[model samples]
Target chain A: MLITKDIKLADVILQNYHLIPIISRFGIKFGFGDKSVGQICTQYHIKTNFFLEIVNAFNDKDYKPYEKLKNMSLSLTVSYLLKSHYYYNKVKLPFIENLIDSLEWEGEDNLKNKNVLKKFFRQYRKEVNEHTANEETEIYPYVLELEQNYNNTGKVSVSFLEKLKTKSIKDYADTHDELNSSLLDLKNIIIKYLYPAENKDITVQILIEIFKLEKDMTDHTELEEKVVIPVAEKIETELKKRY
Target chain B: MAVKFSFLIVEKSYIIRSGLMQIISNFYETGVVNELHNVDTLLKKLSEVNADVLIINAKLIAAVPELILDIRKRFEQLKLVVFAGTRREADEFPGFDLKISVDEPKHLIVEKIQSLINEIKPKKDNNLSENLSEREKDVVKQIALGKTNKEIGEALFISPHTVITHRKNITGKLGIKTVSGLTVYAILNNLIKIEDAV
Candidate 1:
């Protein structure tokens, strides 16, 4: 359970099945012959520091990535975040929805109950979409603008950016934890209330998918709250100082 | 109905302050314009009164970097316009929502103010369900209630494919693709009861 830079990536994923997607996200594949975490990351051209920070953050709740993220590129971190969004929206969400659709129901109100589960999943998906869309359209553009304004050597004035209605990245951060609770509600509803009669195995599979997604989303938001927001705040401060 | 606009101006110079007030008064038929000579009084007055737009002298913003930021954070809906002697001075105060040069034409200033007023006006929800047919509304209500298309079709005596088409139209009309958002919309517009949504 101890995650260190010297530990094998395979061993880490083996210990925590939830990290399988995280490992695959970096394009790391199986069949490594005793390669260490640092070695495999270097071999695959992944940012070793960023990977380690993410792994540590995932493993230990008290671990903070502030110092490591201070030196990291915001653009790179945003790209990684965008990739995670892709996994959630395109890959994991669709897989779960399809699994739910294929489940066989049993009871007098079987159809009605199944519809409730479907509706819950759909609601969670929508909330996620809205959250990610806001980040992509509003927050990302503002951060990029802040970065650009900070780096410009000339007497460039980003007065227009300042004029925008969006006050700060912190506003977006405030809405981060709302999506997690609804997801937890979905898990509870399925497990406690709606029991699929004929296809219990499929129901279990769907629950496993939900559990994996929940972990992934938790780690993703932690990185955002810990890593991305701080970096953005630093850039905003720098931009202000430059002005 | 004519939209009411309000303005708060913070400028040090008496002549320029009154002159700017005159311009705003002449531009709009009905608006409450308050002028202050100091940032301290301006901040204090803002707490007492509600204004849609805040026009501050750029010099004050430069002297106090946190002035605009503080005002913006405090008043989430207030639009900001910095009146500066030059574009360079305006550029130095980057926190203002807009910049109007002191030497700019009066008509341009009026236009800018008008635009800012329009921008700050509370957006009309435009009755998102107005375009939805009765059938579409029923489908949305069912979706919000966590009903699948198949179940909705059975309840409404329509084909599942027709239910999907209704769903598509509902999303297109409301510009909301998610069941949760549609549920909120339904509840807000009174298309579905709050108890049914849960």
Candidate 2:
């Protein structure tokens, strides 16, 4: 179901509790006293439409807000993405890594392969960091500048204009394919090959976390490739003519 | 990797059937042989064993001529090999994947069957639930190195269709649908190294 602005914030939570962490990304706090989504957004200073679109996209996989997202500002998109990165880096990855680190092995064979599994996950964490870091430093800043230059014409910075000469959004978009692949491989390795006997419950918990992370990453990538990149490309085309 | 195929041989003569089974079992170590004197339960046996190759006697198909067409229509993925004892019998048989004659050398029969098995490998066997079979791992390795289905098929000496079959099985077993995800599986499993990926 598409969550709208008038839906109560508590009802939205009841609809999809998974959005609790997602809402937290938007600086929304708990303890809402029977407030609608619009009311909560106003309280939190979040654009209600943007919040709704983001929430609906996460809640329902088929709810692609392509036209709606095109209407959303680039700063809002980038800001939301940055917050997601912060959550992934500071909270999620570390939690998963710690869970993986403490996993207990059963036999000689499983024990032998445990370190390789750990190393593989650690490597994935590293690769994810590299990907997000690249976007954070190189891509997102360029996008924000592209938006700024497009919106505030004749005030385009010289450095930003120079950047426009060499780089394009397609370059970044093309590199989005391998976002959560290693995480997938790690999951396969766990379920298929390197299952732990001791701390089996914790291992299952780790898998649940990994699955959630993969879904979140997939949604994030889909939003970028489908919504953010296309919108920015149009803005880029416009700004290219002026600058 | 060498192919692993379960063979379902439908031949009436006990001597010929046992002889064929012995020859196949000797050289084709991974081949599982099941013999039947009649085609009455062929379809049921095929489904039950999920056999990869079907070796039918031309005489039996000559009696029940529609059996060939029926099997073809139903199990297109099945590798059909005909055992025709004579030139006339061979002529009566359709263009199967392979035709073994009574006079052909045992080595020739083994070679032909081996090549046929190599050309097509079925995916998602029940025994493969715990792990990917060796052939699936090969496909994963090629996939991880960022090769297309055509390229992987050519490299593995299998058809693109067979490659896709393996890919589907790989996805089913590993639950990693993306090529990038399979590539990561390859890397983490040491099927391929990081430097090998493009």
Candidate 3:
């Protein structure tokens, strides 16, 4: 059963995956849709099972899935923003456009739906680009540097991400939590109208595309919380005296 | 089945140059030569793809022993044939199917493919039981465990010099040179468990 809070995220993914029938063709594709839904669910099982795994990690607690779900949604939003350019250019545009064309939506009624889809895409594109620039330019590099130091020395200097002056580690995590809330908002908006359960080629294509996007976004969030932040915190404390 | 072979040729002469081009053309005419520029590039390529056999230039065969270890880890089943210009190079590692320049006619290189094809098992057997005597295997397991030669000798009730001699023989027979390479080989061949080594 899909968790209530995850419903919107699930809807967005299920809808997008419904749009693509080509997922089967990419069975050998190294990542993304080449991966099985079962594989995806297995990877995501930990996060969904104990939502506290994410949010509570930030707060220092045990076994919390709801908090993790919320944190994941926001962390993923920021990550999506960071990688928006690559996603739009490589994945979104080619796959979505090809998907629409494959649907044969040239007729008047279908044209109307296509126009609506285009408008929805426009908002998604703009939001994603803005988010990507914010994270890539401002956030991702800091996290990457943190990861590098932690991997090498098992610590990060306190001032590692101070260039952005985001204040304390707690502040950074709180801001991360805020990002999840925003993502939840975005997900709800997406879930309002996407319907493609007919198993039509277009529906299948959309579902696959959405599934890929959602999975990428989700994994990106998990990377930050599970790996990036904890490593950053460890390094910040270790290098605190040196700086 | 068509025999797919890869070449790890290292010549100071560029592949695009006239003499090298003629050699390449001859190989292409007589056999399928998938040429790699250098040893490092060849090993990296091995990780990304699998091949039936690798025909390495004699110079490359001797130059980067570390890379040979890497290839041995990644492509354990690859049948390696070394075409070296001198007997010294051929004598350096008898474990490889080494052929000196004067002995290696173009037809000899081509004809060797049939045997190499029969040897392409894709993944080399990592079980130490397949080769090596019981005593030699015991010394190798100790070496892989980060034990000193004296410690290995003490454990096995032999002189440190005897342990060293066994190690030299192991390196010569296995064609692996580094401690890390031996570690990888031990793990793969089941000489040592991954946890024990780690």
Query: In order, what lDDT does every prediction score?
Result: 0.75, 0.79, 0.51
On residues A163-224, what C-alpha lDDT tens digit does candidate 2 reach at each position? 88888887774555565556766676678655445878888899899899888888888777
Ranking by DockQ: 2, 1, 3
- What does candidate 3's lDDT look like per residue over A143-202, in tens digits? 556445545655445565464245333345523333333333323322332333233666
Ranking by lDDT: 2, 1, 3
Candidate 1 C-alpha error for residue B64, in Å: 40
* Per-model TM values vs. the true structure: 0.53, 0.60, 0.30
User: Residue A30: error of model 2 in Å?
Assistant: 1.4
Question: Model 1: how far is A55 from its true place, Å?
Answer: 1.4
lDDT of 3 by residue, B72-112 (tens): 77776666666666656576765575453535565665556
Candidate of highest DockQ: 2
Clashing pairs in 2: none
Q: Which structure is stronger by TM-score: 2 or 3?
A: 2
User: Distance (Å) between predicted and true CA of A87, model 1?
Assistant: 1.0
Comparing 1 and 2 on lDDT, the stronger one: 2
Candidate number of the best lDDT: 2
Lowest-sum lDDT 10-residue window in model 3 chain B: B121-130
